[model samples]
Target: MKVLVKLIFLLTMTTPAFAQADFKTEQLKFDRVSAAYEEKWNSLQEALRSAGIGRPFKLYMAAYKAEGKLELWLKTNGQKTHQLFRTYNFCAQSGILGPKVKEGDLQTPEGYYYLNVFNPKSSFHLSLGISYPNQVDRFRSGKEKPGGEIYIHGNCVTVGCIPLTDDKIREVYVLAVEAKNAGQDQIPVHIFPFKMTAGNLNTYLKQFPAHRAFWTNLQTGYAYFEKNHMIPVLSEKSGRYLFK
Candidate 1:
C-alpha cells in the first residue's frame, strides 16, 4: 500500500512539471521571435530615419497583384502625410486578378484590409493575418460562405495568400510588430489589381472587361492615396466600396 501511494504521488508531482515544461517550450518559441526583432531593431530604425520616418509611426501597405509588388508607406508622429518607404516583391502568385469569391476559388482578394493578428509560430515560418471578408467581401460574396484566413506570410508559396520570401517576411513582420507595440493600431493593407494608372486600366479593360467596373471603384481609393498620401475612409453600399 505504501509503495502504491508513493507511485501515485510521484505521478502527480511529475505531471505538473511536464505540463510546465511544455508551456515553457511553447513560450520560448515566441520569445525567440521577439529576440530576433530586438536584434534587428536598430537596423530598422536606421532605415526609417534615413527615409525621414520617425519611431512609433503609423504604417500603410499597398500590394499590386499584377506587378507582384508590395509597397510600404509610413507617417511619422506629428506628420500629416505618409511617405513611401519600401517595396517588397511577392514571391509567388496564385489564382488570378479578382476578388476572392468562394471558399475554394483559389483567388487572392483585392480590396482594403488591415492586419488583424500576428503569428510567430506560423507554419509558413511567420505571418500576419489580413482581415479578409471585410465588409465589402461579405456583401459581395455573401455572409455565410465568403471564406477567410488570408495572410501575408513567409515561405514563398501560396494558394490564396501573399507569399514573400522568408527573409523579406521576417523584415516585414518585425516592422509590423514594432509598429503594433508602439501603438499604431489598424495598419492598413490595400490590395490592388495593378497600379491603376490610366495605361494600366486601359490594359485591364482590354484583357478583363468583366472586372472593369469593380476595378474602377478601387481606383478611386488608389488615386486618393497616390495624390494625398492618406487613406480615405471606406464604406460599403450594395456590395461595392465607396471611398471618402
Candidate 2:
C-alpha cells in the first residue's frame, strides 16, 4: 500500500514537469518574434485590404538595394496567422535599405530570399529576420562573409536590414503576425524600384538619370506582374529575360 502511494506521488510530481518541459520545447521550436516595424506592417494590411488584397492569402517582402537600383524579395504563405509579425527589408545597409556582404561592403542583396524567425527585441524596434547567403550567395561569394541579420525592424538605422522605425514596425508586425496565424507558410514578396506606373516610371527616369539600366530591369518585372496580377518569376537565359 505504501509503495502504491509513493508511485502515485512520483507520477503526479513528474507528469507536470514533463508536460511543462514539452511545452517549453514546443515554444522554442518556433519563437514568437517581435517587431517594431509596426507602422509598415499596418500599412501593408491597410494597403492590401484597402486595395482589395485581404485574408486567406500569403505575404511578399521586397527590398531595394542601396543604390535604389536593385531589389530583393521574399514570399511567405499564411503569414497572417501569426499572433505577432513584421516585414523585413532584405537589402538595407545604411541610411536606406539595400544589400550587404563583406565587412564594410554596404550593399543589401538583390534577389530572392526567405525568412527564418521573428525577432521581437531587435536592435532596431521589432525585426523580421531574413535568410541571406542562399545558394546563389554561397556559389558567388565562396569563402566571403555570407551576410548577416537582415531584418524588417523598428529603430530605422540599418547596417544591412530594412528599418521601418519603432512606430512603423509596431503597425507592420501586428498585421504580419495576424497573417501568419491565418495559416500561411509561404508568402510572396516583390520588390521594385518605384511604383512602376507610367507616371512613376517617368518620374524615376527624369529624377535619377544614373539608374536607367537598373530601373529598366525593374520595370520589366513590374510589367509582368501588372499584366498577370500575380507575382511573376524573373530569370535570364542566354541573355534573354524570362518572365513567368
Candidate 3:
C-alpha cells in the first residue's frame, strides 16, 4: 500500500497540470505579483472568455517603435493562427527608429526574440526581459558589445526598453503569467522600427539611407506576419535574418 501511494504521488508531480500550478504558485509569492493578480486576473480571464480564447493559450507580443504600440496576439484551442487580443500604447519612447547595434546606442532593437526572463519583484513594478543580442545582432556587432537587457516593462520610462504605465503593465504582466502557467514557454516578442508597409518603408529609407539594408531585411518578416497573421520561422545567416 505504501509503494502504491508513492507511485501515485510521483505521477501527480509529473503531470502538466501540476507543473502549471507550480508556476503560478512561485510567481504569486512576490508581493507585487500577488497584487497584480488581485487587481487584474479576474478581468483578464473574463476578457479571454469573451473573446472565445480558453485557458492554456499561447501569446505573442509585437512592438512598433514609430507608433509606440505594443500588440498582444493569442492562439488557443489548437488554432492554426493567432488573433489580435489587445493593443497597448507605450507610455514612453526612447531613441530613434533603427536597430540597436553597439552599447549605449540608445536604439531599440529590431528583430525576433522571445521572453526569457520574468521579474516579479521588478523595480519597475513588473518586467519581462527579451532575448536580445541574438545571433544576428551578435554577428552585426562583430567586435563591439551589441548591448543587452532589453525588456517590456512598466513605470513609463526607459532608455531603450519598452515601458507601459504601471496600470497597463499589471494587465500585460498578468496575461503573460497566465500564458506561462498554461505551459506556453518561450513567449515571442518581436520589435520593429515601424510598421513595414511598403510606403512607410520607402519613405523611411529615403530619410535614413544608412539603415536601408537592415530595414529591408526586417520588412521580409513583417510582410510575412502581415499576410499570414502568424509567427514567422526565422533563422540567422551572415549577420542577416532569413524568414521561412
Q: What C-alpha lDDT do the candidate models reach, one value each?
A: 0.84, 0.51, 0.90
lDDT of 3 by residue, 6-30 (tens): 9999898789778777888999999
Candidate structures ordered by lDDT, highest first: 3, 1, 2
Ranking by TM-score: 3, 1, 2
Q: List the residue pairs that clash in candidate 1.
A: none
- Measured by TM-score, how close is model 2 to the native structure? 0.55
Poorly placed runs, candidate 1 (over 4 Å):
1-29
Q: What is the lDDT of residue 65 in candidate 3?
A: 94
The candidate maximizing TM-score is 3
Q: Please provide, for model 2 over 1-244, each residue's C-alpha lDDT reduced to its tens digit, 9 standing for 90 to 100.
A: 9999999999998886566445323323432332223224456656555544546445555544433322222233433222112333433345322223454465455445555666655566466666665554455456787666666677746665566656655655555455455444444344444456778767767766765655565577667655654566665443233566
Each prediction's TM-score against the native? Answer: 0.85, 0.55, 0.93
The sequence of per-residue lDDT tens digits that candidate 1 reaches over residues 1-244 is 9999999999998886566445324533696466656666678888988887877688889999999999988888778899988899999989988888878788899998999978888888888899998777887786458788899998988889999977788778877776665567689999999999989999888988988888999999999988999889988888788876
- Rate residue 227 of model 1 by lDDT: 92
Candidate 2 residue-wise lDDT at 179: 44
Candidate 3 backbone collisions, by pair: none
TM-score of predicted structure 3: 0.93
